[model samples]
Target chain A: MRLAIMGAGAVGASVAELASAYGHEVTAIADSNSAAIDPNGLDTEAALATKRASGTVGDDSPESVLEAEYDVLVEATPTTLGDAEPGYSHTVSALERDRHVVLANKGPIAERYDEVRAHERNSEGRVSFDATVGGAIPVLTTIDDIGRSNVTAVRGVLNGTANFILSRMAAESLDYEHVLAEAQDLGVAEADPTFDVDGTDAALKCVILANVLFGGGYALSDAAVEGIREIPGAALQLAAEDGQTIRLIGEVVDEEIRVGPRLVPETGTLAVSGTQNIVQLQTERAGRLNISGRGAGGDETATAVLGDINRLL
Target chain B: MSERTDVRAHTVRLELDDEPGELLNALGPIAEHGGNLLSIFHERGNRTPRGRIPVEVDVEATPERFDRIVDALRQTGVNVVQAGAERYSEELTVLLIGHLIETDFSDTLSRFERCSSASVAEVSLTVADDATDASSARIRLAAHAGETDRALDTIREVATEKDITVISPLTGGDAV
Candidate 1:
């Protein structure tokens, strides 16, 4: 399969390398930063160097990811709402050109949910975002497997930075600032974690999950977001005193989606502590199913992106 | 590097029933109020470790429209768990010890979020320097000023509950 990547950042470059390894023709990669992909393929060592130099290697203007004349396009720009100049532009171009789309970025897909789906319908091109919600975990794929079932609700520790901080804080009784600072040092949290800390990142993820599994377009503004910042650390300890832990969770019911802190009972299957994401599914048929995994490491996210490229090929 | 004052964004979480068109029903308010959508993530196949899908979203709009969007969304008969601009104001870090792999620690970090004027800023792990069960990670957290105390409180609680050891701030916020 001939392939191109919409961004040359961490996930994008990783996808390119994976495609090359699987013997797929990764024709072109776009990023104003530096050319990570060529007609032959990406230089894996060079990409790693770039990743090391800059945490990400995305181009503000990435026209090449779209104009590559490839069979498939993988969009992997950093997610942000209302700023889809390159990714959105490239996605539409790919679909219009009659190429399949493998979306790893959530910003544009979440915003233009119906428009892209419409394009897929009219153009008869397949589109999938299995890597958008879960990093290496099969959350989206699993949802795809159990399609068309009415999902009662969703609750999870969708964001890793906050959960890591909370876990440390709960255990060490450290202050918030110290934990976050350490997280930055560890390269887990961003310099400005406005989205992840504030709950927008997880919210966007929830939107994708809901749309893909539950069906229909969702208004992101309507989803509730409660960051871990305001939750009293004492509250978590109180829960702990009772053999429980506070997880910043996202919950979706019939007409509403919720995100905030929840006191998960320790004995329940849902009560997973730390960076691992645990999911429960309640289908009328299956009753309830549990899924858990690593949510936000670079390797994990990159691995899943690779899986998508492999599948697409 | 956008203008914070002019840039209006909100984070919200809601409790919705598992019914048809529930997602569309929730989104109606944002569109009706003229809010520009950013992103939406939904975990549908799996439950909330307890049983429920947690849908998250990011949106942009005027302050007035933002209020309307939230109002309209709640009016759609969904449970609005929490809402706000969610600004962070503090930071901290700590280390953990014990057998993390055995406890399914991967699921542990995923349960927390960057709220409370805080965020998980960093993480460093010593893999027992071997495959043996002993491993440790030093975690960093950032939150609103003075919120570090609460954040540390949360970590200590989680550590005790999970049976992980907390290394130290050793000193205070100044040390970090």
Candidate 2:
């Protein structure tokens, strides 16, 4: 299979690493540099080498990214609406050219799900963005297959920044800033960390899930967004005293969606033990399906990216 | 697109007292005049030198509803510093430079709602690998006829408060 990646971020590079390992041809890798500056877009081997050399990735060079035509296009850019980023054009362009798509990036799909789905309908394409919403939890597949229609609601400890901070607060009694810095250092959180700390990331992820599992496209305004910055450390302490841990939760009730930090009793399943993500899928038939694990580890993300690529094959 | 001769949208720059309930008070008129709330992204944590928080709200209402929302906000003792309607001729594009992944780029879009008149037609992102860094974006701000410039201006101002850079085509070969 010939592959084309739309972004060169951690997720994108990881996907490249996996698909290439499987003996597929990753023809091109792209990023937001409209200039197309670097000539040699890093190959999987080269991507790993680059990361090994500097402990960071360097792919999406102009020459290597636009190397050749591809059998598929992978959407791996960061999620944002409108002209704020790159990859939407690359995805649409590949679709227009009749390429299969595997999406790990959530922005275009979330912002223009209808438009892109229509594009998919018109192409020889199938999409799997399993890594987008649930991170390493595979909530999308779970919702799509195993525990689907019987599902009632889902609550996510979606943002790693917020979750990690909460975990550190519980374990070391650390403040938000210190834990946040640690999260960044661990490469589990974004530098800005606003979306994770805020309810925006989880809210958007909920909208994507809701649109897929539920019906009408959710109104962002209707889906409340409250970041974790305002959540005082003392609040977590109080929750801990009550045998609970604070988790930023996103869920749909009746129709209205809730996104905020809440205290879950330690005895309850929803109470996250640490920064690891815990997603509860409440169903009428199956009861509660709690998906818990390390949500943002690099290897975990890479493996999920590989999983999406396998789907492409 | 619901474009009326009477109602047009303008960017309202507000210096909200860094306190709770202030946002609710500021939003009275917007909801009252049937000013369909397009989006309101309050930088609750980012305070101005005056110790007030900056808030940028985009509304899609008829001219009357828009004015009423503005008026309502003022009447509630909410400080309304700047207000002007946006008239656009072309849909412009721009890039946002910052830790977009870190900033929850999704919330930024939540601040941009969709209405029959104008909405965010498209969006894309480029995340860096190291993760302790900034990403760039190319956004297409699609708006009603003669409303593009104002939309761009409002979005740029919102980016400023969030500490993100806006890269776009020049409007009128000058700042709006």
Candidate 3:
């Protein structure tokens, strides 16, 4: 398949690197500033090397990347709330042009799922966003296997930054501020970590999952979101003494979506440590299916993006 | 016609009140929901504690159709005790030693039975003289191919909560 990749960040770069080996073409790639497009497939290695040397993917604007001819549009842009920006417009443009879309970006789908679906309905292209929620954990594809109607609930540790902090805090018996500082030093948390630590990231993922399982129109604001900043170290120790550990769990049942730190049995599946993500799908007939893997990282997210492209094939 | 590739064999156990049309009424949902009946085992002499007759049914249908069949059975007021695969290829025996009755042994068994990946094939209980004394149970569990470890982990979690000790073979297990 020919692909036009938006967002030349880690995910897009990794997708460009891996797409050809998987028998797919990366015809175009764009960063926030610039883009590179070629009708007969861009030189992925040269494009990536250029992006590393200079901070932009190429000279073409994001709009130009969307205008390029490709069978699938790989959206890997960073997520932003409200309008969900160039990503949303880019998706609408690609779909209107009768091209399928594979999203690694969560903004357009989470904030404006109904609008995206509306565009997909009229367009010849379909949309798949496996990397939006659980990175490379195959959460959405697993949902596809059993059918969405059979899923009763979706619970997971969606954000790696928050999970890393909480797991470290619980293990080292450190306070939130100390752990947050440590995470920042380790590049786990962003310099401005409000979106991750405040539960918005997890909430966004949960809202997207709720829309997928129960249909569209669920926004990040619809979820009951809470962060782990207020969870004291004493509470973690107390829970540990009781053979339980606290994890930042995001759960969606029916239309209700919530993200908060909950006590899970230490030996249980949800008590995953460090920067790992786990998604457990409770089905009406298939029982509980648990899948865990690296929730973040450029290459991992790109693997999911490529998997979605292959699924379209 | 070519055979459907997605079709799977499913078994459903039902408890029906002893009535003239109860047996016929119970089979209606299976047929109505696109299930092709393979066999039926109706125990006429044996009755459940509720005085309902126990019946076991084998049918072939796709997963979606099987879900519909189960729903139809419930809607028609048939007691569907179990509706899934009959044979779990992998088997393991675990022994739980503790206050079995106090920790709710029945609940433990129910949890193991509820897991779709595994099935509680058989259980044997050994009770001490007094109710206050500790007791033990040897549970034989069967799981779908390659799901025995997951099944064991679930049992371990339940055992940990009930303050029971679990003992099982680490290796030398095969599919039943």
* TM-score of each predicted structure versus truth: 0.60, 0.58, 0.64
DockQ for every model comes to: 0.02, 0.01, 0.01
lDDT of 1 by residue, A1-313 (tens): 7777766666776776667666676766666454444555556556556656884443323554465557778777677586545667667788888888887888777777777788888775678777777577777777667764655555566787877877877787665678889888987788998787777877887877677655657757768776766443444554455455556677666656667665555455655556677666656576666777888665677677667666765
Query: How close is each model in CA RMSD to the real structure?
Result: 21.5, 20.0, 17.2
Question: Taking the tens digit of each residue's C-alpha lDDT, what string does model 3 give over A1-313?
Answer: 9999998888988999999888999899988888899999899898888888997777888788888889999998889899998789989999999999999989999999999999999999999999998898999889989899999888888999988988998899976889999999999999999999889999999988989988887998899876877565655665565455677888887578878776566677887889999988888897788899999999999999999999899
What value does DockQ give for candidate 3? Answer: 0.01
**lDDT by residue (tens digit), candidate 2, A34-148:** 2122223435566556555665445335434433567767777777755424656656677777777777777766666666777778887776667777777888888877645
Return the top candidate by lDDT.
3
- Please rank every candidate by DockQ, starting with the best: 1, 3, 2
Error of 3 at B128 (Å): 49
Tens digit of per-residue lDDT, candidate 3, span B1-176: 01333355567899999999998999998999898787798999999999999998877677899999999999999999988865567876665666878887767776664443465666667665677655656667777678788888888788878887564432311101
lDDT of 1: 0.65
Taking the tens digit of each residue's C-alpha lDDT, what string does model 2 give over B1-176?
A: 12322343455778898677878778776766787666686888898888999987767655566667777787888887776444323465555666766776765654543332345544656565657655656555556577666666677666766877554432211011
Each model's C-alpha lDDT? 0.65, 0.65, 0.82
Clashing pairs in 3: none
Q: Which has the greatest TM-score? A: 3
Give the higher-lDDT candidate: 2 or 3: 3
* Candidate 3 CAPRI category: incorrect
